[model samples]
Target: MLDDRQTRTEKLAGEIADAILEGTLEPGSRLDEHMLAGRYGTSRTPVREALRQLATTGLIELRPRRGAIVAKVTSEQLEMLFIAMGELEATCARLSAMSMTPIERRRLGAHYDQMGEMVAQDDVPAYTAANTALHAMFYAGAHNPVLSEMTAGLRRRLAPFRRAQFRAPGRLARSHAEHGAVVRAVLAGDAASAHAAMLHHVSLVEDAFEQLAGAPAGTAPEAARMKAG
Candidate 1:
């Protein structure tokens, strides 16, 4: 039932969301409709729709007269999101540990191998992509689709601030190590350890967001490092 324009608008929305997650679209940046339309090879109508979608997800804010701008991530919001993310991921780990079958754990092991390759190469883009996959797969492994959906929504909402964590010095390497620990804990079926490890992983992000607030706004915040997985 979807028309071409509607499909295009949805696709553009996804692209914009990805850009926000990757830190290419910095927070608080104004989104000019004409420019976005030109950038995406579309008309203003589609661009507007895409912006509307981002607004609904809380990634961007639409203002009267001033138009749309990337939503500013305040310190309080950052802390709240980070804290919530930790709790949610901890719950995911606990659920996955209690419910995942041996075969599911094996599949997660393979995915970890793929992640290892990305980490070894220090390929941020590949690692980021794999990070997303690992987290999604974990939710699946947990046997709770509802929790996965909720977590996914939260991730999208906090994408910009999350990406900024990767900019911190030595964060990527530390994150890689932490991810390995999380994998081991999950594979071992240690529900408590898994929960704690996941919380620790998300706490790293909290540290990054805090450091970012101490610095000037609009500055790149990627150095702090986070294990989104």
Candidate 2:
């Protein structure tokens, strides 16, 4: 069993990761160990662990003397990750459609309903959370543990970019619709359609990334709202 300090270290890691993903910590921003320790009411140990994990995820760079700085996303890297993620997610959706059990299907349906409720309330955080859960469930339903694990790792690497992408106008609404289509295909066991829907859904994200490729990170209007959601 893990001790309290170890558990706190892991929790701090997750919190820092979320801050990175949500752009609360902007790209290239320095992560000060002392400041974070003071902010989170912990010692330097957990903050160091958190920073180390972020460094591994490419969300931060650990400089020998300067401590950690948030990683900057290049256009090429953004395009590459989105293309790969789309292919992987499409494959997962295809397999999930074929493998989904009745219980899993019902649970997936419930997730969609919950997502709809979030959208109805214009709760972007809730919608985004449900969106993540729904896709995670789809990944599990696919039954390929290896692919699921790899996809999850890639998802974490791409989170910061994704948060920026979501700030684009109409993106969230369109994401909800695309997810609905994917759920429909999965429920009907239409593997091909499910794959296509997922591909197209991720393609939307790719389009946004492409458009923003040349734009300065904080200069773009959508990028400016990275902290909004």
CA lDDT, every model vs. true structure: 0.75, 0.77
- Report clash pairs, candidate 2: none
Question: RMSD to the native, candidate 2?
Answer: 4.7
Candidate 1: stretches off by over 4 Å: 1-30, 39-46, 63-66, 212-229
For candidate 1, the clash count comes to 8
Q: What would the per-residue lDDT of candidate 2 be over residues 77-147, giving only the tens digit for each residue?
A: 55678889999999999999999899999999988988877777778766766777888988898999999
Estimate, for each residue in 1-229, the C-alpha lDDT of model 1 and write its tens digit.
4697777876798778656655568777899989888888888988999998778767789999989987754545556777888898888988888888998899888988887777678787677667778887778877888898888888777765665566667667777777777888889988999899989988977776556534543343232222221
TM for every model, in the order presented, reads: 0.77, 0.78
Residue 164, candidate 2: how far off, in angstroms?
3.0
lDDT of 2 at 58: 74
Please give the range of 10 consecutive residues that has the lowest summed lDDT in model 1: 220-229
Query: Candidate 2 at residue 229, lDDT?
Result: 20
Q: Which candidate tops lDDT? A: 2
Runs in model 2 with CA error above 4 Å?
Answer: 1-29, 38-46, 64-66, 209-229
Worst 10 residues of 2 by lDDT: 220-229
